[model samples]
Target: MGNTESVVVQKRLTRFRPEERPVIEGVFDRLQGGAGGPSGAPGKTPAGKTLTLEMLQSSMGSLAPDSMVRRIYQCMCRIDPGMAAPAASGKTSTPTASGVGREQLVIFLADTMRGTAEERAPLVLAMSQHGAGAAAVVTCEQVAEFLQDLISAVVQILVHRGRLQAWKPEKMGDGSLGVKLLAEQMCSELKPSDQGACDVSCLEDWIFRVSQVSLYLEMLVAEGLNVSLSSRLAPTLLPPCRETPWKELRCLLDLPVLMFLAPQLPDSYNAPWRLVFSTQLHGESFTRVVTGLTNCGPTLLLIKDTKGHVFGGFASHAWEVKPQFQGDSRCFLFTVFPRLRVYTATGYNQHFMYLNHSQQTMPNGLGMGGQHGYFGLWLDSEFGRGHSRARPKCTTYGSPQLSGEEDFTLDSMEVWAVGKPPEPEEGEEGQGKRSVLHMDPEVQAIMEMTGKTLHSQGFREPEEDQE
Candidate 1:
């Protein structure tokens, strides 16, 4: 009879709620005076009992700030049907689904227990994989709404934490705000596409605006402008811009001025176009000059000083070239985008004889003295020799001759600067002559014939001049 009653009691205990069953067993064991007596054992507390309320209140009080926040997040997650039941296990007395294991429920509950706002701040802004998954499952409108709320909450937190500072928008050239408010407005006004289109166009636009703001801040820093904001915000204000096709093209086309320096070119002659500047050449000087010209195209040349490195301007055949004297002497000017390759020659005979005998010895033997001579016309070779040697007596050629019938005729050639111009002599009439032009009249004429100005000195439009 005792064994049968025990079996019945066990069966009855099994029927209790999973959460309640543990407490019931404790009470039953205590009542039967098994192991611990009723007074000694922590027995089951009834729903309306003082101990039950105390236990509930204690559990609630023990929850961390993060737990509270996670509880709210779990509530948010319940939007998905699969996530709903697991989230409801905290307060419900009903039996959980077989798929919702006790361990999983405990993990969810533990996460929710850390519900304080402070604890949740970092997680809220963190781009979580789960968040991304939720975003993928949800509509873009929902995502945008969530992001907006998240950003607002973050801003509020920052403010409350005393990190908020007034940041003024950058000013444009016209003294207007440069923050691209229009883009922001568009993002706010446009409805996100619902077709799961990964058009991060809005984000891209925002990033670009931020980059511009960063640039403005850098300029301000350079100008010694005072800014109250922390320097850390500089990076935040300017994130990397997304590379669109147009941006990539712009990167390729925006050639730097340093490309014009002569030293940067390849060692051997490889450029498709050749530049023939009218200067006296002596011995093998022309070889050095040509090599220097070629070299300029490849190297990133800089003029160094104590201040810092300064970029030398790029050389191109397209710039203006005017011939000062015409006598089998024509100054070639114009720029060509050359496909260059390095020239390789084996043997000393080939290297020396090639440059000196064949190349330097112009057809008429009217070669400028070789690279070694005093009257050498090649500027690049001499410059490479450095100032340590006795300065050559050769009168350095001034700018290309601007006069003569062939003057200003344009031709397809590549131009690069090999060396810095000699410092002006004291009391010289033209103390500072920095600009050099290699004008090709042929190109100018063709451009003029086509009613386009090959080179315009001022801002006058070619069409206006034609009219």
Candidate 2:
């Protein structure tokens, strides 16, 4: 989920589909609808007419762009074809073996929709509670919209509920309340193909894999947008965060995206990495921070905008303060909070996203340089409002067709490094042990950026390696 490599690609990654789908038309028919008549209020359906799956599906399918269609297809793919009684009666050809996921989905829906009176599915009741007017005879579009909103609301509730109930907060050795970030836990273990149990961690990882967060980031870069993290964040979220200090921010960095796109790292350089440098992008520390970066290790950059939104990039090359682009095909950009997106480095165009443009010239120009577009990260703390990007239009070397945020606000950025683990001393046979761990208060603050904590409650001395 960190700036790691992927074992699978878009083409190779497989999506499972059930051989059949439960005819859910009846489910909609079961939805309570208000009666209509000549004397009834206008814009109502006739007394017998009601919302149905066909109407909803048709309406959804009519929307532009094939992704929606594909999403519907994948959802339908989760339906169990064998659930159709006609197949058992031989009215249909032999049914293919049903997928557990598909079958489970069907049963799950059935359970959710179970009714006490047998007059309507329990889901109908649930929908009504969520504002699906019991007033019958809604339009197909209205039904479709209601269902979409319902799903969004449900997912949001489910995510935060999971966080509140199970994930306990622990005060770290530094006395800072820390909930282990799914991102840190997943750095080494997550994979796109993993179909493990649907635990919270797994659910989080799966969202990173399947969601179009990366595509959105790429579009932003392709479009040359430099805006506040909030503007960039709203679209890529799983369940949008409307309130401040969103607890889910910690998991923003947890995504199943590989940073470097081409030219894999040499075996020796592929060792695990730990956090090193982290600071606000606007401080005077900015110059020393940029100069301090070495090409000896991989670098991960995380940026937070004034709005409390966070995003970043992973560079395969050791970071350097230079006018020219450095590093391999491995560099990529990403966002953690409000959902994950990791945009990989590319060489499609002559332009490149580079770092380091000044000496005593000081923190004025864009430090994070990008391609074909004026897009890049910039911060002059004294300026009050930093620039993330504006009207970004140039396509990246990747030339992705997807669109991105054209303008955004900037607040701060964090840069971390990935390098070989410290070698064992002669007598010490394995990895070194450290009492205090993975990230610091600044690190935790970045993780908790969306939470109520404005700053990390603790700060340990810098590591010797960093010094």
Q: How many residue pairs clash in each candidate?
A: 53, 30
lDDT of 1 by residue, 325-418 (tens): 1111111111111211111112111111101223343321111221233211222222322110113221221212111111112111112232
What are the lDDT figures for the candidates, one per model? 0.25, 0.33
Q: What is candidate 2's TM-score against the reference?
A: 0.36
Best of the candidates, TM-score: 2
lDDT of 1: 0.25
Each model's TM-score? 0.18, 0.36
lDDT for 219 in candidate 1 is 26
Tell me the deviation in Å of residue 82 in model 2: 5.0
lDDT score, candidate 2: 0.33
lDDT by residue for model 2 (123-211), tens: 22222221212222223232233233333332233233352222122210111101122223222233323332223233244335432
In model 1, where is the ten-residue run with the lowest total lDDT? 168-177
